[model samples]
Target chain A: MNASVTARRLPIISLQDVRFSYEGGIEALKGVSLSVARGENVAVVGGNGSGKTTLAKHLNGLLKPSSGRVLVGGEDSSKTSVAMLARTVGYVFQNPDYQLFCTSVEEEVRFGPKNMGFGRDDESALAERALKLMDISHLREQSPVSLSLGDRRKIAIASVLATSPIVLILDEPTTGLDSVESAQLMATLDVLRSEGMTVVLITHDMRLVAQHMDRVVVMSEGSVALDAGVEEAFSDPDRLRRCKLLAPPITVLAQRLQAQGVLPKGAATPLQLVELVARVRGERQ
Target chain B: MMRAFELTKTKVRYPGSDFPALDDVSVGADEGEIVLLLGSNNAGKSTFCRLLNGLVPNSIPAQVGGKAEVLGRDVRRTSVARLATLVGMVFQEPDNQLFCMSVEEEVAFGPENLAIPRAEIIARVEWALEAVGLSGYNARSPSNLSGGEKQRLVIAAALSMRPRLLVLDEPAYALDPAGRLDLYALLRLLRERYGMTIIIAERDAEEMAELCDRVILLRNGRVVADGPPSEVLSDIDEVVAAGVSPPQIAHLSSLLADRFPGKTRPFLTTDDAEKEIADLVRTAGSGAP
Candidate 1:
């Protein structure tokens, strides 16, 4: 068979005009429509009350939409059980303490696949691969509860990764990590993306989005405020500010320089800005 | 004036652990000063914060050595309740710290337990809520408030005690950029107006450079670098080697300086970097870069 048909991309997760309200009748998500293609890296960013978490909850069947529909892998989310969706989409909550219950790191990582009916050997293999991917192989024997927040976060992600889901959703994964730890985690995600894993990252850190993500979905006041490529999404700071978000610091610096006519345009990452300055210095010489 | 707190040769070890959580760490902050803690995870940032609030050896059972003093009280000898009056803590996860149903009750809980007069407790509750920019949220439930609002409420709960020193652990890690700006502004107000000494452990250098006066870097439970933000954070190589990334503006300035030697001076914050870059362009005869 020719590879053309097999290589065709389709939406892995789709939210069609989904609307959701919390228990107190607070409408958290107001008519959100979006789609995620397989092997894509997307970031959902917004203020606290903008319904980013509410929208994510619908993807894994944690909350059913009040109106419209949520489709995961072309399957109706409301009809499928959360357990069934877990096989396709692995969601790691913002807090590592929420889902971490096992004693040892290895046990925590292997528990997911074991419950999913994988053989003991297959479970060990999956756990080992995930631990290695997250660079936490050395901490396998340690108690997960006693590990540092950064290490525990890695264990949480590895545990989810061990299930071998087609799509991974991480909420504020770098909340308690340093720059190096955050960079290392994002690099691991890059490696997974290169291997055809679809990732949906929800965070407030714009630098990560500017450097790593290709697409950004900005939420505001329980609505989809802006959805575009990274450069376009960050190009307009006023629009992002209205959404209660700000461009990354390096981006803002470049914008300030751009306004002064020193540079033609602003850049999203540090390396790009350095190169632009280098080009300008070369031209002046 | 006397120092707000002083920690000397402090060491902390947890049960069943091969290594100490904090190994012979000695650090302190002055009154009305904002000190920022920079380090990777398990670098004893939280442990240090706990030491100030008497949670290290008092609330949590851990092997301790050396001396810790908060507001002239010995941390190892004093009770956590007494130290609570001198030190306030705001943790990364606000939900774990907040328990009251209404916003006002949460802030009043600490003062009420201390047997403060009814008139004083009411005034404190009002002031604490207003201090955190949650004045109108007094009647609302903590569960119903947004993430930023909950964080403010937690801070209010700490402030209600009228502590002299405040310790916050990654307070803005979960907040949006706007919320973070608001938090930093409030922190500045506390230091300037209220004269409260603040010690915070945060990972975001971009935001901390402007708000903090002193910067301390911890690695493997040891203080590697400690100085002012201008000096400590500007050295990108040193900061990164200590297991923390420097601010983007600092890193950017370093890169430009590398390409054009002696042309760019080190700047850490966004406000400073803008001026530095514009000056470099102006000096280079800017036409089109």
Candidate 2:
């Protein structure tokens, strides 16, 4: 492999003029074109029926486009087998119950690696490491079916992580999780990104998107309404309103303060917002 | 009237679990009040909601102790069907509860099972749908509705029973922010118009703080904190330690407490925080120093 040639290769996942419709003629994706580079933390956000999930499915070859093309790892996704693509992209469903069927938590996490044809020793190591990363190593012996939703979600992510995919797609991973669990899960994803894994998250939590993700893809009526960096995505109010989304509460506060010239123009997380407010107070005194 | 529901030192352990799902939990809500249950997953919030309608003891095989009462009926003694008449329950997943062909049928299923009069059932079906802002969706298939619509349909079905109290276990789990706002608005409507007591088990304390009259914080199957939203949410350390993040406004107020002195108070919504900050800036600009 030529090092510079490989470095300049196309995006890891690319979709051009992709359109998809369900069996009953319900158009889910109209004409969405997007490109995601390696090791990118991207968040897909929109209203309930704006086709965020549909677009995610195409990236993993779960669904093929009606028109145009989807390329995964520089290969045509539609021509590739989903099983073959599974090694490169691991998709975690929103509900763990939809995918989890193993007897034990350890077995559940090990299933992905085993299915991907890892050796027995490697499988065990991956499973153990994934479980430990998710903070669920203690539940390795427990039945996944008997665990709480939050714990099951962690198990599902661990199972996907055990597969060691370069690209990870999570569909609303924090839907039922509390703030602490959400923060912990995001931290795990951050670590994975640091280790050169690409993460694509589908979520409705603006706070998570603003604080965690580097890029944002806003979907509206099956098309890409806005695709920009985290700051740009939240700062653009018109596009967000067009897609029936709002900036995180902290961002909204910052915007209000900015309007009054109390704070400089910028998007801030809750913690950052506090620091900004304190700085303004100090300046006033 | 007596409190809507009260749990007195209630404890529940599942059939195979070693630890209790709910450990000596005691809480109460008044009539026509909205209570938000804030906790991390497996903190007994669902178990507490189950106890409201006898699902803990009657349906699930659980070791139970102490007392639970809803609408003057002991949950331990009352049949699940009987408790359903007074305590309406909506679960997290709407698909789990919806089975009828059409929205009208789905709404009427609850009342029909209760052996309500046919005329009253029809009236209730109409009333419930209207209350949920789905008045014209009676003939629509539940499968065809959006996630938010399905959730509202479930809420309508629960309301058709005309229960005095409604308990929802993470009802907004599947909804987007817009959908969640609609649901919260509908919940406030339900409380104001129908005088229904509402208990919501939620993870988003920020959104809940603006709507809930009181907040109940649970951790490790125990009640760690219980008070009005302002007081309960303002204790940032306690709330965060319990694995529940306080609302952004509450966090901001706490951060600004030293700077703003006595003016800083727990705020539930962005508008509240904005007003306080704007006031502070105005005072400073007018030569307060």
Candidate 3:
């Protein structure tokens, strides 16, 4: 788990006593605190109304906290323009339709870089890199409306990545994606992490947390319920239940076998079927 | 009862596209049967679903050819208002169909739109909510509910319409594991208890194989395969080529079927696969690899 060492060197983003309420007087975030260091891939997991999206919006200055502070690259987010925030932290909305405003994929990918005042040649270079990163380089001239929903989602992500933000926040990135799209997107996130991009992925998929994240932070009712390594977070099924999440089938089966005396107690969460087979074989050995 | 007799032989062409979204396709569904439509995205799965409720030719831009009937009525001729009473549709995105302030209102919208008696509307709303296991959610706002709750609410709204068939187009695609489980239970209850002919356009091959009585495999708007899910899903290469994720246990069994050929079964659920494996282990004894 890429837990911060000194909160320096990588004090890229931090939330202090953050609270948010909509115009209708509904409190979405309540005194939430979080810190994300540079190069850390931290997954924020929770139920639907658990303030994960609220927390994510704060990271990129989309939704400023009411009574507290949000620090982006050690600068107070409230004082910064969204234009400036977009350069330091890129936010990808869950529904691609909400974000994709351009006509063609190439133009969509170049929108952010162009807005950030890059010249035509530089914008083309950034757009090419982003589209290649998303593996949609061939779709440069295709109309955004003509692409599949999965492809549109990737274009939205590519548009965000074109800005070249150090801290990237994705809200429910895998929603509505088929298994193949989910795998491809997760691989892209893995590559992004390897490139020293700090990623805060907000999602409800525990399998995603188990497979991709460096750390998993559970949120319940607008508060941080559990913050720990992925193993530690997924180990406690009850805590996961409280947060309204479920372990993958393999992990549940392993736990059941352990309970039924077919396997040793304290069996780890098995992410894949091979891991479960290995666990059972080790126990028999 | 609700039955489709050699139905779905329709040719649908989208706007400005020469190719049919669904080519000549035919299938049938019986009352109390859960029929799973398995295919990848843009495989005319959604087009087939729209054909069920007559939304294809009515609201959407499409030219549907041939006879596509639902509940003994020609879908092309049947008005959407009349079709809604026979086949209720729950779309993939719950937000698109929902606009009511409270859960009760959302469910009641269908019955009230049909001009059902207020007393009967309340009763139907209650029964629908109970069927979806959201009995006490009448006072709750759909906007504030979880993704699963909103999905179930959509199902309840369809149920309140007293439809003979329920067509769900990827209703659980956006949900988490627990939410998906809840939706599965709700679908099962609709078929078993209420005798609703449930048609699901799904990508989860294993779930369809286990829960559905029959499977309809569509490819480029054609009925490539139509049979019991066991036969359709057992062909792993076909399912993979169609871009469908095979059931986890079926995948595992296929992996071991090379070494232990007889142990292979068209298993969908994890426990069923485990039981089959355990029984095989006992029979094979030390010969198992």
Candidate 4:
């Protein structure tokens, strides 16, 4: 491969020994190093105060690292303004109320594009496209304040998506959503990922990590405890324990069956467990 | 048994809205019962909770019809200030309800407003903090606590009111798994020690099923199913179609039931599902074929 092409193919987001601390000398992140490929879907999971949110803020220049370096789109984050990074990295806060301020849903979605200096027509087009993507087109004229938590969350995400960032970061996106809405949101994220957007989600829902994310990053005590593919991450009991994280229930059941020699290893999902049990039964018959 | 609260044919239509937020809904909980309200967004779970404390018609401009009674008083007739002494509500966002400076002040604010004796208010604040496992956090600032701690503080503040019924709307939505487990244990402790009646509106059916005595499923502002978790959550199709996910164990059991008819029962927890799967494996190992 050409050197320039390989350079272009470098990870879309990279952190080299990043460290962050609050004003009270409390370190939120400690010497963390990670990289996200161009279009990977990664989940960051941990207990409360485990630095997942802090680590996410570094990707979009919302928080400058105390030491070390963070590179977004191969540019040094410390040298770039959050407004400048907004064109390539869009962040959704855990509480949609924190991000939603526009009177109407359509206006909320257009705020980001308009802030990014897009022309009036371009901003409207982007906002309309984002509204349709989030399935909230009908709610365009409705005030976001009068909407439910789920709808407000959708509006928050659509607002960020209107900016057309290459890397999208969401903190606890499924916190207030029901299962169906959560699944729908994940499907929409998958669609965005397929369109070459890198998705970084900070979540406590282990089932979502297993079902949607391609890779998992487990944080513990302000550090990265384990980073691997979803299956590899969930299958390791010690790593999960170190981070105070629980494997998905289906994974737990599969692990027990694997222990009793009733099924093979590495079944982390419900569908996988069913398939494995069927295969074992077939062999017995 | 005494009824903690009851609603009959309740309907609430907000001002200028075409559809009613709550439509002909009826549900009730006995004293000391732990009831869970499960529904998707805009399914009227919060509306139903608001009606319990007279917030629907008293505060918000809504046309509420039918009957809503809390602590032996009609909600439509009782004032919100008076209902505060009978029913305590903890909303989803902890920050929204917390305005006091210190944790002690937050817990004491409610009782102090109720004009309880100064000594009694102090005692209640300490008791509430201790009940929620925040005994030493009296002087800590609410902004300095973690999300889970803030929620616990809110619960403690509600507990200080010593209301007959406690309603929590998605209290554990922002908590982590461990935090959720802690909350479940705390709720159980409250039920066991204080004999408090808890009504939780949550989407995590799996954990709530294990904790709550009754599960009420709502759809489009109406009750679709109301029963024990074993019966209501077992109907995976209905629950999922209503935009609520059943427990993973229940989903697994349903799948197993499809594979082997009449041999499996829906489980609400991992332990029961584990035992069921173990027995199935053993039976398969035998010479049944």
Q: List CA RMSD, all candidates.
A: 3.9, 3.7, 3.8, 3.7
Weakest lDDT window of 10 consecutive positions for candidate 2 chain B: B280-289
Query: Tens-digit lDDT track for model 1 on B1-289?
Result: 6577787888899888899988887777778889998887778889888988999889898998888788778889999999998899999988888898899899999999999999999999999988888897888999878788889999999999999999999998668898888889989988888888999997567867889999988888888888998888878888888788777887887888887788777777778778877777666655433
> Candidate 2's error at A126, in angstroms?
5.6
TM-score of chain A of each: 0.92, 0.92, 0.89, 0.92
Q: What TM-score goes with each of the models?
A: 0.89, 0.90, 0.87, 0.89
lDDT of 3 at A89: 92
> Between which residue pairs do clashes occur in model 1?
none
Pitting candidate 3 against candidate 4, the one with the higher TM-score is 4
Assess each prediction's global lDDT (C-alpha) against the native.
0.86, 0.87, 0.80, 0.87
Residue range A166-274, candidate 2, lDDT tens digits? 8999999988777877888889888888888899999998988877888899998999988887877888777787787878788878887898787776556666776
Q: State how far residue B233 of model 4 sits from its true place (Å).
A: 1.0
Model 1 Cα RMSD, 1 decimal: 3.9
> Which candidate comes out best when scored by DockQ?
1
Q: Please state the CAPRI-style docking class of candidate 3.
A: acceptable
Interface RMSD of the candidates, in order: 2.4, 2.4, 4.3, 2.0
TM-score ranking, high to low: 2, 4, 1, 3
So what's the TM-score on candidate 4?
0.89
Candidate 2 per-residue lDDT, tens place, B1-289, comes to: 7799888998999988989999998888889999998898778899999989889889987988888888878888889998888989999998898999999999999889878899999999999999999998989999999999999999999999889999999998888788888899999999999999999998678677779999999998999999999899988899888888777778778877755677655576788888877777666645563
Tens digits of per-residue lDDT for model 4 on A83-150?
99888899999989999998999889999999889999999899999999899999999999999888
**What's the DockQ of model 4?**
0.52
Tens-digit lDDT track of model 1 for A1-285: 122432366788899999888888988998999988888888999998888888888878888889999999889999999999999999999889998999899999999999999999999899999999999999988999988887889999999999999999999998877777888899999999899899999999899998888889999998999888787788888898888899988877787788888876747776688888777766776
For residues A173-232, write the lDDT of model 3, one tens digit per residue: 887666678779999999989998999999876667766887777888888898887767
In candidate 4 the C-alpha lDDT for residue B125 amounts to: 91
